[model samples]
Target chain A: MKQIEDANQEALRRMLAADPVLVDVLPAAQVIPELTDRMILHAGPPIDWERMCGPMQGAVMGIAVFEGWAPDLETAANMAAEGAFEFHPNHHFDAVGPMTGMTTLSQPVMIVENRTFGNRAYCTINEGLGKVMRFGGNDDEVLKRLAWLRDVLGPAMGKALGAGDGLPLKSLVARGLSMGDEMHQRNVACSGLTLRGLSPAMAETANDTHDLAEALAFVAGNDQFFLNIAMAMGKAIMDPVRGIEGSSLVTAMSRNGTDFGIRVSGTGDTWFTAPVEMPEGLYFPGFTEKDANPDMGDSTIVETIGLGGFAMGAAPAVAGFVGAGAASGAANFTRTMGEITVGENPEWTIPALDYLGVPTGIDIRLVVETGLAPSINTGIAHKEPGVGQVGAGVVRAPMGCFRQALETFAESVGVS
Target chain B: MSETKVNQFLKTPVKVVNIGLEGFAKELEQQGVTVVQVDWAPPAGGDPKLADLLSKLGT
Candidate 1:
């Protein structure tokens, strides 16, 4: 037990000490050397085409077409079914994405370097909400937007970021929390802060005025723009915490619509999975629970590093939007989560909780003992592919995965 | 025999604290008895094997 405790503390130290900087933006294939042609990386744990939820399948079809592997969505779908393409979880390639997280070779990916550990993590840009590929919309409109991101915004931001040393994310996230952005369902403040940091460089780096204005307007227009950066930041922070022997700290928690999976520090890359849960919250008009897909995405990585739902107390404004409850009730979610974690992140504190650090380091031992699953604030996608976002809400990580992780962890430590 | 302590206690105003399932607490509330419901479940969702492993880890 002491060994486990020590290992967990070391894991927490590495996580808290992480310096995730927005270093560059480039095509996925350019940065992730393992991403080969026709190889598509998706969100959550490893899942095959047959088992992928409608949205994920839809996104994959869209990406296949976007990559020119197929002539159309129809062809893409057929190709996917026929095994014309390879699918792997984004986590496998040191990347993460949100919703029906579809990361392909051609899509532009934000690169965040953990300067302290000299490792990097990647994530594709957030296609501004609705009828976009991340939520499984794969029509011409979606393809066009993906192309724009790949051609314009990605390079502009990459040039801006390159103009100087990359923007460090820790302080920006802290400031966002102070201004009511939880870096998950709500990232309004951080998005603005990120634009303010990059707009100047973007203006100077752009080849022309029109391109600069378009790029600036795009970042300013999309409120969840920073969510992708946050996902990459979370990935950057947590990657270093992986493989700490005897540590029970969770390194990743994600869902692929069909299944929710978690990887623990001690267990290496093995994913303990269970049937995913549907989000419970307010839906957009004309939509209801029946239209919502089970929760999905690699964005829960934010919560793994003590943001998102774990920092909900700092963003009370998100409570009503996510249907968590009245603004005052938000702090209770963070408080309940504290019991299941190994420690608190001092740098990311909630003023509402008297400057208490956000709960960090999810410990499987505590999760099993307390029977409290990690709560995630998330966007609800329609179950039918290409329908776009249905709503936003909160969902709990299934306990079955934690139980399995604990059982294996105990056995691994010779507990028999 | 005269009323036992249990009987005497039952004769007084009834107040209850309920944990786990909320049905009992709801029933008590419907009967006008004061009740405090605590949201809880059997650790590990009542999975015996997980509970055993948890105990082994000294949780």
Candidate 2:
């Protein structure tokens, strides 16, 4: 048993030691091996279109039109109803997306490689905050932006990234934490940093000056530009820790609009899920609880790797979004999360903790024992598709899932 | 600035001496982490049957 724990610790070490490099940007079909036509990769565990929440369904419809499989919204909706598409989770394919988190053959994704572990992870490029397809916005404007991302931003980024072996994301994330960006709700600083990192490459490689300027400008204007990269980094780092027999650490935590789910390291690819919880959040003007969708997205992969809410103490500005309403309360929340995690990530230090590493590995056993499920800070999408973002807030991964994982893990360890 | 000590929990065997968040401690206990309770009944005897107990429970 002690040896098992040691193995788990080693797996976690390798995960934390990962230096994910931003390698390229390409269409999902090009990067993700199994992503074929007629397949849509949504968040969390698998579900058929019939069971998908409104936002996810909406995103899928947008992608259908974007792929030219359907010419209009009405036809796309009918195609979805008729089960013309195969829906799988981003987790199933080593990919993730924010909100409804559906990735299609045409959607552009960032490719990040773990320098130490030699594995790669993918996340669709963020569609920049409002009325985007990932949140179920299937309107023309929404589809247009996604097309631009697919055509312009993706290629420019691919060239910029290929200009070097790739930028090291580990140090960038650590620096973001110190600069008051939790890499979840508040990526203002990190996005700016990304622009700085890519500008030279973009400048050097872009054939057209206007395209380079537009791409740099687009990344600069969008605060969440760093989020997809961060999620890929999280996936790149955490994927190596999955399936270590006898280890109790959580390798993944995410939600499709309908359910919140987690995968444990020792448990392999099996998911422990609970009903998605509504967030206690600050709403945008004219939007309230009713407008907010249940928690969703592969974005919580950030928390699974101990950024997001676990590093909130470093990004006090995220307090309002966290329902804490103040910097000190956010800091306390981060400290409390420490109780459920195995240890600090020595590399990803938080300034508020006086350079202490953010809480790293979430041990399902410890989470169940501590009665504290992992905390997540996330963007709240509209309950209906196409309404875009409604607000942002804090949520706890339901304790029930962790409890179930503990029971199974206990049984595996022969602890009756 | 003085050097901050590494978090002791990282080095020692897992154990939690919980003060107010007993639900947290209970989950940890269920998961095989060592948890020691602080015998607290709250400042004012907290809610009675407010099956809205999640609110009454400390976060």
Candidate 3:
């Protein structure tokens, strides 16, 4: 009991020490990696896009056109089908994308720099669920939205962010907690705060009222506009504690459209992975389990840093989408998460826990011993291609991944 | 918040939190509500008597 208590205390200290700031964000094309034509970053299992379920293939084709790699969806489809384009999971790049969080060479990304640790991570903008190319749909609407994000939204946000002295996400998350936002499904508070921070820069850059109107409306309409900032902030916080000798803490937890992976401080950069599963929850009309994609994207960073589902009690509106007894579930999830974590986040505290800090970092060893893999509440991608979002739900990281990570950590620390 | 479901937990009242409120665990303590923060961990399992205890609390 003493050992457990000591470990828990130590965990809290590490979390409280985490002070992450987002300094810069950009695209993967700017940061080079050894990516080949045969690899595409799918979030779950490796699906052969050429022979993929329709939606995945469609997304592949759409991204090709969006990248100008292919002139049209048909050509993109043929190119992927003909084995010209390779597939890889986003994890390989130290990046996380949103649902169908697809990034071509052209997609603008928020380059999150952990100012404290001097490490960086990346994630693309939220594609706002459904029939979106990131889930493998290749329709004109998907292409147009992609075009707008690339040509307008990205640049606009970039300029606004630069002008606003850069958004301080940790503070925003702290405020969001008070206003009934877990900074995941209910981002209203954070979004409002983010816009307040960035709108001045946005106003300054626009040449006309129309541009200003567009920018303001964009921020107003999208509740999840703050996700990129939160992701960057999470990257900043987690990066500080990475490579902590003798520490069994989780540094990263993310999914490419293909697999769920985690990186631990003690384990270095290796990703322990498991097959991704669908979120179980309420679905939009005409969508069901068949249409849901396995969980994808880097949003898990929110949960990893101890917000999102762990803070769900603050955002009961999300209860409609996940399951019954959401408030109780949220508190329980946060409490259970505390068992596997190193500490509570001093800055990103949760009020429902009676001002208790949010569960900060995950430890692979505890996961194995407790058989309690981290629970993530996520948006479900369409299972078949082109369907978009089917539902929202919760899932557990596979025990196998944690077991593998523990084995690797044991070998590294000579604990075995 | 359903009364039927609330009544079903005839054990110690399961505290819940909504809108930045304290959780059921803390609330039960203040009201002298017969709630204990049981070991929710698996294996040996949660408090074995909570079921009977809750039934009594309900009465």
Error of 1 at A290 (Å): 1.6
In candidate 2, stretches whose alpha carbon ends up further than 4 angstroms from where it belongs are B1-59
Backbone clashes under 3 angstroms, per model: 0, 9, 42
With candidate 2 superimposed using the best TM-score fit, by how many Å does residue A171's alpha carbon deviate from the native? 1.0
- Interface C-alpha RMSD per candidate, 1 decimal: 1.5, 11.9, 15.5
List runs of model 1 lying over 4 Å from the truth: B1-38
Q: Alpha carbon lDDT of residue A223, candidate 3?
A: 82
Superposed by TM-score, candidate 3 places the C-alpha of residue A217 at a distance from the truth, in angstroms, of 0.9
Over A1-416, each residue of candidate 3 has an lDDT whose tens digit, in order, gives 23323543454465566555544444556653654333456443344664354555667777777677788777877788678887765655656666655655666777666554466666676665566776666778888887777777777777766664565566778889878787766688888887787777778877677767876787788887777667656766666656665556777787655567788776677788877666767777887786666677777877878888777766666666676354656677778888777666777677766887777667665676666778777777677666676677887777777767766765565544
lDDT of each residue in A339-391, candidate 2, tens digit only = 87878888888877788888888877556545666788988889997788878
Query: Best candidate, lDDT-wise?
Result: 1
Candidate 3 ranges beyond 4 A from true positions: A1-15, A22-28, A31-56, A324-329, B1-59
Candidate 3 residue-pair clash tally:
42
Error of 3 at A253 (Å): 1.9
- Model 2 chain A scores worst on lDDT over the 10 consecutive residues at A364-373
Docking quality class, candidate 3: incorrect
